[model samples]
Target: MTIKEKEEEVIEEFSFFEDWMAKYEYIIDLGKNLNGYPPEQKTPENIIKGCQSQVWLHAYMDGEKLIYKADSDALISKGLISLLVGVLSDQTPADILSNKLKFIEEIGLNEHLSPNRSNGLSSMIKTMKAYAIAFSK
Candidate 1:
């Protein structure tokens, strides 16, 4: 789906649930829908370092915008990465670099996550954002 449509869907789902349990479930479901990366695409070159879970991410410039493809071995981690991609994919590198992922906190997920999980997610996001910076340079 288009980012706008996905955003609308997220907002609508949030409107209905308004509770963290429901929101977390929705996020997990969203992750379940993440497209898988072919074995060839999940090469060492594409691997995102520092995540506790195995993550592979590839980013390329499409015209003036950056597009991303990513995956992870762990289920919820995959979903978390999908959530990050949903939040930042298709936008300009500059946009991705400028806007903080404030939604994680706003959604009340950050505080509930274990310290290690939070760090792993942070590392994944940092790698993605760093790629945007690299591509934009």
Candidate 2:
């Protein structure tokens, strides 16, 4: 599926939750289902700066698309990254760079998060876009 399609799917899925608590449970499930990053790739370079918890993100170009792998020590953070990767991965670098990731706001993810986690989410988005920018060049 395209990025927009994936994002819409996530938005629809989140819409089913009756409250933030249920939404959080859904997010935690996403984290648990994440295809974890390799131990070897958790280098300093892969570690995302500005996040309170350790988050390692790695990306490479696949033909014209970008493929991402990531892990976070925190469950919520892991789920957040997995959500992002699910929506943004396997897309062209230009597409990723141009995306604003409105799903976060659409699903009320940012509002429900703690300040630190909110910042970490932003950091993850920045890191992903930076990778896209670099790879697009």
Tell me the whole-model lDDT of each prediction, alpha carbons only.
0.77, 0.91
TM-scores of all models? 0.82, 0.96
Tell me which residue pairs clash in candidate 1: none
| Model 2 score (lDDT) | 0.91
Local accuracy of candidate 1 as per-residue lDDT tens digits, 20-98: 6777777678667888566678888787777777888888889988888888877778888888888788888888887
Candidate 2 is scored at a TM of 0.96
* Per-candidate RMSD, Å: 2.9, 1.0
Please write out the lDDT profile of model 2 over residues 15-68, one tens digit for every residue. 999987899899998888897688899899999998999999999898999999
Off by over 4 Å in 2: none
Residue 83 in candidate 1, Cα distance off native in Å: 0.9
Best by TM-score: 2
Measured by lDDT, the strongest candidate is 2
